[model samples]
Structure formats: C-alpha cells, structure tokens
Target chain A: MKVNAKKVLMLTKISKSYQNNLVINNFSLDFNYGDSVGIIGKNGSGKSTILKISCGLLKPDSGNVLLMGKSFDSTEDGLLIKSRMGVVLHEDMLYPQLTVFENLNFYSKILGIKNVNTKIEELSTLLNLSDYLKISVSKLSNGNKKRVSFAKSLLNDPDILFADEPESNLDDNGKEIVSKIFNDRRKRGLTNFFSTHSEIFLEKCSNQLINLKDFENA
Target chain B: MLNWFKVLSILIKKDIKIEFQTKETLVTLCLFGLLIITVFSLSTENNSLINQNFGAGILWSSVIFAGSIAMVKFFYHEEQNKTLQSLLVMPVPSELILFSKSIVFFIFLSISEIIIFLISSVLFNLNIFSLKLILGCIVFNIGYSVVGSFFGVISSKSSSKEILLTMLLIPIITPILMFIIATTNDVIRSELNSNFQTWLGLGISFDIIFLTLMSYLFGKILED
Candidate 1:
C-alpha cells in the first residue's frame, strides 16, 4: 500500500485525566484517509476518552486535535469538520422515546440529507432494522439498539466514523454487517477510528491497531 | 450559507413529535399543576386571610414549581440516551441546540399554564381571560424556558438533579416570579392597573436579557 494519502486526523501530545487519575498521557498519532485505526486497551485505559476528545465531545487537558487540518476552536471550523464525521459513544445516543425510523429520520434531517425516508429505509434494510422501524428504542433489546445506533452513524455516509466498542452487543451476524460496512467505507477512502476489545472484530474491520498502554510510557 | 431556520424547524418538529408520542412532560406538568392547585385550595379553604390578594402568589408558585418539573423532564430524554452528545457533534451550532430545547419547553410550558390557569380559575373563582394575563404568561414562559433549559443542562449532569435544578432555578427565577405574581394579582382582581404594566415590563426585560445571555453562554457551556 502506498502510504501517500492526505492526513485526515492528528492528535499531538494529548493528555487527559479524571479526578487526578491520569488516563491518557501524552498520546499522539496521525491517521490518513482510508486508514482504519483500532484502539485497544484494558478497562479505564482511555480508549473511549481519546475517541471522545478527537471527535470534540470531550476537551483534552492539553493538546491539539486536528481533523482534516482544522481544529475545533472556531464554531464555523468545528461545524464544517463535524459535518463530515460520525460518532457512536458508549451510550446508544438514540432517543428512547422515538421509534427506530424516527431517530434516523431526525439525524438525517439534522445532517441535511435529502430524501429522508429513502435514506432511513436504506439504512434500516442494511442494519436489518426494517421490522423494528416503528418500535420505540426503549422497547428494543440491547443488540437491536446497538444496530440502530450504528445505522444512525452511517446515515450521512460520513467521511469519518469514530465508534467506541462498536461490537459490544452485536451478535455474529451483526458483527459481519458492521465489518462489511466498515470495509466498504474504507474502500471508498473513508477514515475509521474505533475503540474495541474484540481482537476478532478489529481484525475484520481495521487494518491498523494501537494499544493505549503504549501511551502510558510518559 | 444554508439557512438555519429550516434546520431549527426540523429540530423543533422532532422534539414535538417525541413529546406528543410520549406525553411525559405535558402529562407530568399538567398533573402536577392540578395537584398543587388542589393542595392550595384545600389548605386555604374557609380561610379569610387567603383572599384574592394571595391568589396570584398561589397560582405562580404552582406554575414555577410544576414548570421546573417539566423542564427537568424535558432534558431527561436527552441525558438518558446521550442524545445531547449526539447533537453536540452534529454540524449545527451548539446554541441552536439549546435554543431548540428552549422553544420546545416553551411550548410545553404554555400548554401546561393554560391547564393550570383553568384549574385555578375554577377553584379560586378567578378570571383567566385578560389580554394582560395572556401577555404576562407569554413573557414569563420565555424567561422560564430560557433560564430553565440553561440550568437544566447543568443540573442534569449532577447526581442530585432535581435538588440541584430547584436550588439553581428558584433563585434565578425569583425576579420573574415576583413580576408574574404581581401581574397575576391584577388578572385575578380583573383590574388592568399600572402595577400590571410595570411588572409586565420587568418580565419582558428579564426575558429578552436572559434569552440573549443564555443563548450566548450555552455554546461555551457545551464546549466543555
């Protein structure tokens, strides 16, 4: 593989801690377009924290996070960069009171994706959620809810996807579907950065891997 | 630049749709409002000390207390599933998210107030149809929703959410409550006096000032 792609994400000397317990220490990495980086770590090792910081959900104690050469300092720059990204955190992030279809539809409209129904229908079909489109998110099982979350992140055909434990509640078939989606997106030069503990899942979906323990050397 | 009005409209629509589907905020607010009125009516029955003069105080206390509950319930949905975090990462500006929340809660609070007014009117034998009263309600609702939504986000992040919300909310809304009570007193007495005008002016001022300030601070608050 010719590693000449444009750098899509960069984290330089990032440091973060909670309650005086340092989680990520001087972490640094750069990801180019089409690079599928999987972050692996033990519990409380800051895999999710790094993802959150990179996606601008959590501000790092000190460091710079550049997405496509722009930081999240200015609202206009932040909005422009985030418009091309998607994220799935530990929580499902879908409204429990809303039906599966309504949740997707809401996000699609927010992202300004036209033909909302068609976009939602396509994602529902891809995620095997067509039958549950009318069902409230609170009524769905954990695995089903995970599928809905994944479907939401993919609704806009995001240029970058940041997911934490994307395979947490997924079954084998669900895992395959997610892996296929990731692989397809990668082939189209979309960047994927995710945190997970499943080696098998990472192997199927990612081409590069980083262990958070290495960052603790500081 | 794509106009953000359409985005705001869709955001409001989604919130309204979810609210109508669950009826959590509306039902809780209205039910709590009615219960407060019943308790007040019972406590003051046959008590000459509690005449029309105190009726405004009683009515607004119920409105503020019950409105606080509805405000907390309004944000609960966003916190439970981390939907606020989802919205934070979206392309839209952060202040717009807060604005949408305030708008939705404003609508719910208005509906809740109508029910509260009807119940209070029947129980306390007070009038409820004055244009001044309606104007006062609108002003009060805007002030309540903007300040409530701002503090509601902070409180929802705490372990003691309801207590924190009340502690933070009650003090900030004290001025608005005072003005509302004064206006309501005139409404209950069916007298459009200078006092009503002064209070309404104060309430409207508070609304405009707080709405702008909260909207400005909202984005900074979410950046953390």
Candidate 2:
C-alpha cells in the first residue's frame, strides 16, 4: 500500500474477529483533517469495533492503523498520537463518584491542558453543563452524563475525536448542542469519527459515511 | 519527564480520593484482616507455643486474603466505570497506570497492615512492631502490591473476577508469603540476627524482579 503522509487517520486492511467469527474483514479507510466521518450499521455489525481499533483501544488481528502519519506499533508514537486524540465510547467513562467538574478536571490534568478551569467552564457552557458542574455524575440523567462525557472528549481540544453512538441517551436539545460542537470542530479543521443509528444525526455531523452493511456482505 | 510525574501523581491522587470517599477497600481490608486475626487468636488461646509459631502465619495469611479481596473491590469500580479504559486512550503510558495503582494499593495495604499488626500484637501477644518485621513488611507489601495490581487488572476482565484474582494472586505471591512469615517468626521469637540479611535480600530481590517483570507485562495485558 502506498503511504499517505498527509492523511489524518489511515486503517489499511484492518481485520478483527471474536471466537472464529470475523466482524470486520479487511476493511480500509483513509480519513483526512476536517472530515466528519460517520459509520452506520446494524447492531453487531462492528461499528464500535472499528472505532475502537482506530483509536488503539482495541487491536486488530491483521493490518495497520496510522494516526497523523504515526502508527500504534511504537509505544512512544502511540502515546503521542493518542495525546492528540479524544474518544467517547458506549460507556460514559467518567468517575460516577466525582462531580462533573471534578471528572472534567481530572481528565484535563491527564491531557496536560493548561488553564483547566477556563476550558472546563467554556465546554460546560457550550454543553449546557454549567448548573450540573458540581453534581455527582451518578445523580445526573443519562442525557447529562452523555453531555459530561462529550465535554471530557473535548477537554484538550483534540485533533481528532472518536465517538460511538454520540446521540444515544441525548435529548433533542442535547443532540443540537452536540451537532453544534461537531460543526465548530469541523470549522476548526478537526476530524470526527463516530458511529450512530440516527440518520438525522449522521447527516448533520458527517460529511463522509461508511456503511458497514456493505463490508459485511463483501 | 515532569509531565509523566504529574500524570502519575494525578492518577494516584484520584484513586486515593475515591477510596477515602467510599472507604470500601480500606474498610473491607481492615475488617477481613481483623476477623482472621481474631479467629486465629481465639483458636490458639492460652497456648504460647502455638502463638509463637503460628502468629506470623496468621498475620500474613490475613494480609494476603484481605489484600486480594480489597484489590477485587478496587478494580471492580475501575472496570464497571470504564475509567481504566479512559486512561488507556490518553497519553499516559500503560506502565504508569500499573505503577500508580501499585503505589495506591501499597498505601492502602500499609495502613491496613498497621491496624492488623496492632490488633495481632494484642490478641496473639506477638512482637510485630520490631524494626526487622517492619522492614520485612515493607518489602513484602511492595511485592504484593506490584503482583496484585498486575493480576488485579487481568482478573477484572473475567466474569468470576473475585475468584480469578485470588487464584492468580496467591500462587504467584507464595514466595513472598513464605519470606515474610519466616522473618516475622524470627522477629517474634527474638531471633532477629538469624539469617536475617539473607532472607531480607531474597525478599528485596523478589520485589525488584516482580516489579520490573509485572510492569512490563501489565502494558501487554492491557492491550486489546
């Protein structure tokens, strides 16, 4: 395969399986900066698996994943690449015992974001999380928890964000805020890679779409 | 380098903070440890010889059992909450995650040890406060925390995690368990100078080797 140094993310012939069942078979994709890519598929169709593999959360049995011209093969390079990326998976991935502000603060510290308070405040406002900042995550509704998770992914103003079902558990207003966030990220030339069942959400946030149903038949 | 330390400290702080808020691990460890000590003490009542010979065994066994139970509770929350997954996607090195957890577990184990020892001293009339015993515990705790934290994450992936953690942890830590028991026996019997250096050296060696080996393996186990 010819290498593209400028591609923001590249997955070459990626294959993954579980217990002799192949979920993603020799799938390949190239994502560039500022491109909002949406992956749609039925349940068990490997939408989340591909996002997990691309973010280095899960490893593929075969093929290579490159982010910003760097691969996950090298530990140092993997850490560097991950530092520039953000991910929101099916789980909220927040400490339920901690308040929303504390959860965001903890993540911001790990991401090495300076001016932590200001950035958290800004995101909280954008996500309508200002009132719920001091509330424990466990006390929040699913929509609020998703908002907090969304805020966390943007804590570092990451170069790329990978989210699975970004609209799950979100209300109409919460979905609109998420749409706006993606739009703003796109305007700033940041990439978004997400999986969703919502056709309207996919259309609003994604300029490029990959239907895994096609890959399954092939 | 500085950023690495900053991140490590942050992770450690987070674990400690949550632990304090819930007191889940510490309380469970202390209660379970004390129960073991109480049973052993009651069974060996008025038998000084049995107490002299078996006090260390009772103490260290309690430590092992309690530590394992506490580790299960500790990592269960990390798995249930998917916080460990969150950390994996960040710039933090996987080894650092292991190291930070080991440190936090070390702290919790140490605190529980202090309490168990004090209670054991009273119930079993054993001299657990000696310099030699304390040093031995320091070595053993370091080894336990490193090995336990490593296996804790592995077992956390399973459905029968509580049993899996203990099954994986006990066999691996048998050598350290023997070392501490032997040294604690020497300390309790006032035979402090009897091959003390040799056993201490062995304990320290086990700690360093496992800490290095487990740190390397932890990163690999966490992948995919």
Candidate 3:
C-alpha cells in the first residue's frame, strides 16, 4: 500500500458492465507523476464510468487497477483510494442545505484538516466563494455549486485530481480561475485526468491530450 | 475533541438552517404536537381519574409519535435532494456521520418532548422539577432517537420509506418506551417503596444497549 510518486496508478485491460451493458471494454490506462490526461468520448462512451471505476465507485467486471502497486478490491476500497484523490464528477456533490462556509467547514473537518480556517479562507478567495460563504447553498447558482465541489476536491490537496466536465457550468472568469488552479496544481506535481466530451480543455490547458480524435489515443 | 465536536456542531448548524428556512419537518411536527396536547388537555380537563392515570402515557406517546414523524422526514429530505450521497462521500468515520445526523434528529425529538412536556405539565399539574424523573425521560429519549436513527437509515433506502420507518421503529423501540413510561409513572405516582433502583437501572441499560448497537451497525448501514 506504499504508493510513492514513482509508481502512481496503473490500469490494465479495465472493463465494466452492468446487467449486460458493457460500459468499457478492454480499457487500459496509466498515470505517471505530472501527467495530465484528457479522456474524450461521445455520450454513452463510458467516459465518466471509467473515472468511477478507477476511483472504485463502479465495479469493473474484469481486469485490475493498481495504485502504487496496491489493488483496489471494491467500490468501498475505491472510496478509500479516492479519499486521497480529488474527484469532481459530472454530478453535483454538495449539500445545498449548508452555507458555503459551513460546507467547507464540514468537509475540511471530515478531511481531518488542521489550519482549515486558513485553508477555507484561501479557497474562498481563490474561487471567489467569499461573498457567498454565509449564504445558504440552496440559493447559490449552479455555477457556484460547481465551484464548491471543485474547492472541496482540493481540500486535502491530493496527489491526483480528477475533473469530470469541470468546464460545463462556468463563465469566462470562472474558467480562468479554474485554469489558474489547474496550473498551480501542475506546478505542485499532482497528476490530473480530465474526462470531457471534447479536447478543447486539453488543448487549452493540459500539456498533452489523449484519445481525442480516435477511440484509442494512448 | 475539537474535530468530532466541530463535525457535530456543523451538522447541527446545517440541520437548524434547513429547518428554519423551510420549516418543513419541524413545523409539521409542531402542529401535530399541539393537537396531541390539545386532545389530551380536553379529555383530562373534566376528569381527575383520566388525568392522573393516563397523563404520563399521553405525554410520552405524543412525543414518541411526533418524534417518529420528524425522524422519518429527516431521511426523506435527504433522499429528495441527494444530500445523503454527498455526506456519505466525506472521508470520515461512518459512525461520526451517523451520530451527527442522529443528534440532529435527537434535537428535534427533544424539542418536541419539551414542548409537550411543558403543555401537559400545566394542564395535568404534573411535576417537571424532579431531577430523577426528568433524567429518566432524557435517558429514554437518548436511546429512542439512537435506535430510531439506525432503523431510519434502513427504511430510508427501502421501498416504503415513510411507512416502513413507523412499522419497524415501533417494534424495535418498544422496550425503550416501556422503560421510559414505567420510570416516569413510578416517579409521578409515588407508588413504589423500594423501586427507584429498578427504574434507574432500566434507564441506564436502555441507553447503553442501544448506543452500542447503533455505533456497531452504522458502518454497514453506510455501505448499503
């Protein structure tokens, strides 16, 4: 279970199916240090499903996923692994009942964060969630909620950050804000895998792109 | 100490915010709590016998019933909004999440109990100042809500969430209710000679048994 940066993550012939629908067939991927990968596919191409399987949210029918040589046995184990990784899936992963400040407070505490008051302040300013901190999340626009999810994913500053359709619900400034965060993360040597419908984000942000023009682009 | 406490407090804040803003769950419980108090007050207003005999039962049953409504509604709100899924994803001990939420339900239940306790005490002229009797009520309540939360999470994921919580919660929590009422009546009626010990023992046992069971099983509940 001692996964150093030298050996990040490995997936060999990863496949997933549910009740006979094969989401991904014979999919293989690898993550090295400082790697920024874009997973591009059309709708129903099992893009998000691949991310879920890697994080242990979805069960792959066959094949293996290795993170620093440790195998993720099940979905629960995936969450354990994912606890060390920041993931922003296409879904909205936030509680609207909580204010922006309270949402960060709760998540940072759960992350066992210390200096979290400072951390929250930093995140708020970086993402511009300051004015909305005390307001109920129920009143926040969709864009703000997505920013909350993004900030939460950075709570632990994991070695890897997964962004699923991170650019879908943002204005020009929000996109710039995210791009800056991505670059800062890159400087810190964090591995990032972005899954999207197009490679626009990759061309604009990632140093390299993958699987954009074809089904297999490793 | 600070971490879990902070989690507990944040969870409480979130629940109170939701309650105050929408007034959906607690408001409904408050209306029902008032009706139960009204009916019991009217029925007992004219007769001393009914008032003395069934007053504690009436008060406790109203609390138990109203508490169930709120307990079940708590889960319903989470289900409708997908909030539970987000909470589950947090990297914390599963029991902490369960207990933090159970504490919220406990607060709602305690509030309902206090509201009814105040109303019924004035109407029936019952004693609310006895330390031992009040402690017994609190003890019973702790177990009641703890067990209620365990089963509430269970029913919330099932087919008939609201209906199943009542059906399942009643049978599971019967022992806690019996002990609470028995202990309450023992204190109020001044009937037992050597009996303070038995009531005290039952209260402690009820708290211990259910709290342990809840913490033990909450992990599996989250996985489900």
Residue range B1-224, candidate 3, lDDT tens digits? 13567666767777777788777667666777778878878877746567667866887777777777777777776766656656655544557667877777777777766777777778778765477667876787788778888888788777777788889888877777777777777656766574666766877787788788888788765543
Ranking of predictions according to lDDT: 2, 1, 3
lDDT of 3 at B35: 80
Cα deviation in Å at residue A72, candidate 2? 1.0
TM-score (all chains, Cα) for each model: 0.95, 0.98, 0.81
User: How much does each candidate deviate at the interface, measured as C-alpha RMSD after superposition?
Assistant: 1.4, 1.6, 4.1
User: Where does candidate 2 chain A have its weakest 10-residue lDDT segment?
Assistant: A1-10
- C-alpha DockQ of every model: 0.73, 0.73, 0.30
Top-TM-score structure, candidate number: 2
Which regions of candidate 3 deviate over 4 angstroms?
A10-29, A40-46, A56-83, A112-118, A128-131, A202-218, B1-28, B157-160, B193-203
- Candidate 2, B143-166: lDDT as tens digits: 999999999998997999999999
**Top candidate by lDDT:** 2
DockQ score of the complex predicted as candidate 3: 0.30
Residue B68 of model 2 has an lDDT of 93
Model 2 root-mean-square deviation: 2.0
The TM-score obtained by model 2 is 0.98
